[model samples]
Target: MINASGVLRTPRQTLFWRVTNCAGAQDSARIFRVEKYFSPYTPIKSRKSMNKGEFVESLADRLDVSRAQADRALSAVLDIVAEQLAKGEKIAFTGFGSFEVSKRAARTGRNPQTGATIEIAASSVPKFTAGATLKAAVNGK
Candidate 1:
């Protein structure tokens, strides 16, 4: 519950924490109860995902190369992977992972809207299998 000064009401009603810049506001400091710092009272933010462009910029910085060069390198790697997968060949990076073509057999499926049966055609798709090193890194080992 919220109290008079817009602070959350703790069980003790005497507990309060000085929070600065909560919810990305303009550094507005507020008194929060110890428990209110976790959820609906204030939203939690996770790490942001990196897109291709951002990855290219980061790569350029790390490799001490021009952005164009980094983009071209990244593009080349992707193109090679696609070419290899097109040939039904596997791509492996020892400490990273492997990519291979997975064959999915045709099957019959139901149409939820019409409740009619349909046949799904067989297809080959690229799949990734993470290696132990990558798995450990992801799991923070």
Candidate 2:
């Protein structure tokens, strides 16, 4: 079973068998398999949490450019995004998503490893909300 937090509690074999038998099932199983094998349960530095190499490669193919060029373009785009967000401007890409600045209120949290209380400072952060097209595509709609 999957939790509200998007964690799968079932064994791999169980998930595999169950997903494989479903007719025309979306490839969530493949995604889970890739995530399981490729990435560890570590904190991601950015909000998007995408794998850089894979993102660059895919962009290269889509944009018909070299990987290096794709990487540069992606970096440039991200830099622009960050700049706009820093200025409290909202950015919207027609088919992809919108990025807006959000204010996170200061809150108290616990350090899981040490069991110590910690204060999380209030801050403005960029948040992304996927467009309907992107969401539908991800959901195989």
Candidate 3:
């Protein structure tokens, strides 16, 4: 069982790594390392914000591409995404998620403490809906 604040009270199962074979006379055949697998209900940490330059460098390292090429590719892809969203279109990537623009209706809101009435303007904002696979992985299913 786990609490709302992410503290585990009881675990249903535990895992361990075991050595299966020994190729040499000096090699040890039996070694175990315990591993705790989080339950499906565990909460995940949110990702930190990354600027374009940092994103490019990370992608370059992961994809084995030059930083310049990664920058260009990343910029182009982001531009395309922004352009599609600007045109009120939804972009879907398999195993990832869907990005779409949602419209918020204008409404009256109050200023806290001051109790002043304020007019909130209607606006369109981008939203993401995670795909099933990604959602499952996040939930540790």
> What lDDT score belongs to each candidate, Candidate 1 first?
0.79, 0.75, 0.77
Best by TM-score: 1
In what order do the candidates fall by TM-score, top score first? 1, 3, 2
> What is candidate 1's lDDT per residue for 92-130, written digit by digit as tens?
999899999999999999999999999999999999999
Model 2 lDDT at residue 11: 28
Estimate the TM-score of every prediction. 0.67, 0.55, 0.61
* Cα lDDT of model 2 by residue, 1-141, tens digit: 655544454422212112223446566754322233213443333335458898999999899999999999999998999999999999999989999999999999999999999999999988999999999998889
Candidate 2 overall Cα lDDT vs. reference?
0.75
Better of 1 and 3 by lDDT: 1
Tens digit of per-residue lDDT, candidate 3, span 43-125? 32432456778789889989999999998998899999999999999999998899999999999999999999999999999
What stretches of model 1 exceed 4 Å from their correct place?
1-45
- Give the runs in model 2 whose Cα sits over 4 Å from its true position: 1-50, 110-118
User: How well does candidate 2 match the true structure in TM-score terms?
Assistant: 0.55
Clashes of 3: 0
Question: Clashing pairs in model 3?
Answer: none
